[model samples]
Target: MVRITNTIDIDASTQQVYAALRALDAYPTWLRHSTVYRGTKMRTPQSGKSLSYEDSTMVGRMRGEVVEDVPDHALQFHQRKPSGSLDALIRYEVSAAGTGTHLTRVGELTTHGMLHIVQPILLRMAAAESERTMKSLKAHVEGHPI
Candidate 1:
């Protein structure tokens, strides 16, 4: 099993941070490795409904389901991949920090089947990707013109 987590501070309010994070349409503007996104389902901010996004990554395009959500606080999901040892769980958390917001993103992978042998490599890759995603998100949220 591989677990990767990254946290960053954004000079934005929790609402602003959460809005940017939860919107699938905003992902391409923030998530660097998510070069392509399609088949997105989302709900209004007040609804607290479910949303899903199909993201294209270096590993391949995968469908992720929003399994957990807590308004401006957190979001968690699992990525479904077929015929691979990769089972992925991704989570994002946001909280107010002074005049800004603290954001954390974690991606965990469990390897099985024939992919067990490469668990280490896969874990490292997940770490790098998770970090990159956080950096991009931070840049997007903090860089917004006031």
Candidate 2:
């Protein structure tokens, strides 16, 4: 398994940051991945709620569920292959920082199956991607266009 954690301070209130992070519909505006939905219905994030999503990323298309959504505090999701291989776990933690908001993201990737062969390379890529994503989140919450 590979784990990567990144933290960023955004110039916004925790409430503002939390709201923006929960706005799944606005992901494409800041997130590099183009999200595609498998189901027509969309719901807000909440504990035990699962949302299916397909996102185009550097590693290609990934399908995942956004689970364990703790309002204003944390969000977590698990990505798995159609064959049932656990690919990754992405988590977000938010808190008040001074007069702004502090966001921390943790990404854990399982090195099972064929992924073990390229684990090192994949780990580096995941770290870089996490940094990029945090920067994008900062920009998005600071009223800047990503």
Candidate 3:
């Protein structure tokens, strides 16, 4: 498994940050990548609720589902290739940081078949992607570009 993590502080309340996290449709406006919510089953993210969607990444379209949702606290999602060769886990932890919010993100990827051979490459890309996502998310919640 390859793991990568990143953190950022957004100048907004935890409620503000959590609201932005659940706003799937507004993702394309600030996210570095594209996550198509056109087919998402859960209109509102909540604990135990299933989330399903497809995202455009370096590896092409990938499907994912929400595995955990703790309102205003933590959120986690899992992704895997349609062919069942690769699995990825992404999670976010949110907390109140004075007048703003502290966000921590972690990403883990496990590869099967031939993907294991390129685990090192995936690690690098995942780290970069994680950073970009954090920065973009911070900006998105803070209501200005970072």
Candidate 4:
């Protein structure tokens, strides 16, 4: 498993930022116009809620789930290929920073079988992806002016 962390401070309250994160749909779509569908009955991103997504990107098809959700604090989501090729766990942490919100994202990805050979390259790619996602979130939360 490899880990990458990205942080950004948004000019919004922790609750607001957290709400936007939980909203999911508010975040701008990226990488092949992937659409996320929540398969759980709960409206809130509580634990055990699954988000299944099919992206024509690198992974092709993947299954995702919410492992943790703490209002105004943190949210953790996990995704992986059904064939056990690629696995990623994403966690977002939010805190109050000078009346604004400090958001941190931790991304961990593990590659298996044939993919394991290219894990280093994939790590770098995932790191760039993490940065892009965080920037998009910051921009979206800041009214698209950032």
Model 2: clashing residue pairs? none
lDDT of 4: 0.73
TM-score of each: 0.81, 0.82, 0.85, 0.81
Worst 10 residues of 4 by lDDT: 30-39
Cα shift from native, residue 134, model 3 (Å): 0.4
Show pairs that collide, candidate 1.
none
Which tens-of-lDDT digit does each residue in 1-146 have in candidate 2? 77899999999998888888777667766776522222222344456557666555545556777777888898887776565434889999999999998899999888666667777877877787778778888988898876
| Full-model lDDT, candidate 1 | 0.73
lDDT of each: 0.73, 0.74, 0.76, 0.73
RMSD of each: 4.4, 4.2, 3.9, 4.6
Candidate 4, residues 11-35: lDDT per residue as tens digits?
9999888987787544434211322
Q: Whose TM-score is greatest here?
A: 3
Q: How high is the lDDT of residue 109 in model 3?
A: 90
- The best candidate by lDDT is 3
Local accuracy of candidate 1 as per-residue lDDT tens digits, 2-93: 67888999888999888887787767545644432223444343365466666665556566778888989998988865656467888889
Better of 3 and 4 by TM-score: 3
Per-residue accuracy of model 3 over 63-143 as CA lDDT, tens digit each:
777788899998888988887777999888999998999999988899988878888887777787678778888877777
What ranges in model 1 sit over 4 Å off? 33-49, 144-146
Q: Give model 1 RMSD, 1 decimal.
A: 4.4
Ranking by lDDT: 3, 2, 4, 1
